[model samples]
Target: MTAISIAPAATRIPSRHRITKVMRLQMVNRLTYLGIPWIITGVALVISIVVAVLISVSVPEPGRQAALEGMAYSWAGLSPFWYLAVVGVQAVSAIFPFALGFSITRREYALGTLVTFVVIAAFNATGWAILTEIERAINAAGLTFHHFTALWFSEVGAGSVWLSLFTLQIVIFAVASAFAAVYARWRAMGMLVLWTAVALVVLGLIAFALLTGSAVPIIDWLMGFTITGFFAALLIPATLAFALGWAALHRAPLRG
Candidate 1:
């Protein structure tokens, strides 16, 4: 009689485990995601300080306080937030193909990318909040330098600052992810169409505002929102963009 042989069955990994693994894979390039952004922020802070000093020295004595107060309105401290959007694009355009080659499903990759965004947003938000407090302390010491706590943060508490930063980071990152997903699925033409549509929508909004004569009122209403409230309102668009990105990735080609 001939001997019979049995083949072992393939073991399936749990969904959560696979998702976490993909997240870890996305975080492999720490310098791109973390280091460069902070470096840019540091450089921006230094530049802002130098500018503040120069303004203090060059301006007439009576206007010195006014110039420094205006300097407190600078947006240099949030420089890293814009860079995070580029990081988001890189996360999808560069990393997706590698993950696919490793047998990662599109769903797993999407979840992993989203989780990575959340982690990064939280980390950066915490850092920004801490820096805001430190900036406040420096200003308190009669330095008159303000970088991290500019704009609406001039009137808000620490918790509001953190919430605003966290929400804004999510919104920026998610929007960039959506754009990157479009590029991944359709390349240059896709990006062109996306930008064209964006421009059209912006023009339409501008026309509407001009025709309706509500521009000033709209601006006033928007400016009326508290720091926390404004960022909270951003959650709506953030959710929509995040969902669009996830959906786009599901059909993206591995080679794009």
Candidate 2:
């Protein structure tokens, strides 16, 4: 007879450690955390380089004018990474059920999901910082390269720039996760009602602003805050979104 060995049940790690393990599990073989960001950044940088070279060689006149005018480049280079929010939705729809089947609790699922979003956001922010520095160096060397830094971004300090980017991405991911949780719990009917209410509130706000002539003042007031301040303010909403999302996930149904 072969010898058999068994471990004691009391030897298992604590629940918090188990939850963290669940969180790390999501990151395994995951592309949203770093892979998609690198792909988007690489493609955007390649396109920028090619376009800059082409304009320099063929349409040198406009290129010269733009360089002289101190025109900023597109700040939308990393916008593609924003789709990670949608991926968050899909993760819940797909991963939550599988995780539940494996005996993971609702809290673990929610916390793991949150950690995954923050990690992805931070990784992208780091990539943005690296690209921004490279873009500045290239332009400083008189190469006329304008890819990462916009005029607005240039006005902000480098630390603020990266912090704002990281904070904004986290807030967006949190909101998206909440929206996804709503739909996952309520399905199509719930989503329709949610969107309808959102539209009505938005329209009412717009009408009120136009009627009262506060739109321009509102815009001006908004523009007064520094980017860091704006992102810091968003933290409140982000917290609410995360809370709501976690609550929804707590009672959400699982399906194949």
Candidate 3:
């Protein structure tokens, strides 16, 4: 006689434990992997200030000098957020294979990655909020430096500021994750096809709008929403992207 034991499927794939494991693994290389973008952003900020100062000193025109005084270099700070796309891409392109080696199921990995990205997005949004407030205070003190308080970023003293930032980050993260999953399953050709498909869709939409003479109405509709509302609306696409990304990764093959 032989004794045998079987565990339920749910026990085998407990969502909480699996997600925790993935999150822990993600944190292991957090410094080296996550810190690179922040470091580069800091260096760029310092360089831009130095360059601006040099330009201000050398340029002779009074109007040009005044224009340079309160230059809204908000785009500079935002450039690093794009690096998060690379982070998401690496999460799949690099870590997904390693996680699979540990026998983590695709469902668990995908959910865990989503949770991890949300947390990262929240963390970044909080930091950005703090920086934004600090920049505002500096401007009030007549420093004229604008690091985080761009017109599109937030309305002054508005509560939706953090929400808008978080929403934006989530949408960007979801898009990156979806793209990475596509690449993981299909590699270089997949990315090319994806880009081409996106281009065609955009072009087709433009043509349709032009032919229908509905471009103004469409633009007007878009203009009706506040920035926060517009970004909040992106949550729908973000959710869709997450679902699609999970589906893609579910059967995604390991790649080098």
- The models' CA-based lDDT, in order, is 0.88, 0.76, 0.77
Q: Rank the candidates by lDDT, best first.
A: 1, 3, 2
Question: Cα-based RMSD of the predictions, in order?
Answer: 2.6, 3.4, 3.5
- Give the worst 10-residue stretch by lDDT in candidate 1: 1-10
Residue pairs with backbone overlap in model 1: none
TM-score winner, 1 or 3 = 1
Over 54-154, each residue of candidate 1 has an lDDT whose tens digit, in order, gives 98889989998888888766788788888888888988888889999999999999998889888988898999899999989988888777788788887
Measured by TM-score, how close is model 2 to the native structure?
A: 0.87
lDDT (tens digit, per residue) of candidate 3 on 119-188:
8878877777777787778767866565566657535354566877788889888999899898888888
Candidate 2 off by > 4 Å: 1-11, 62-73
The predicted structure with the larger lDDT, 1 or 3, is 1
Residue-by-residue lDDT tens digits, candidate 2, 104-138: 88888888777777777787787787778877787
Supply candidate 3's per-residue lDDT for 121. 79
Clashing pairs in 2: none
Residue 191 lDDT (model 3): 86
lDDT of 2 at 184: 81
Greater-TM-score candidate between 2 and 3: 2
Global CA lDDT computed for model 2: 0.76
Compared with the true structure, model 3 gives a TM-score of 0.86
Q: Which candidate is the best by lDDT?
A: 1
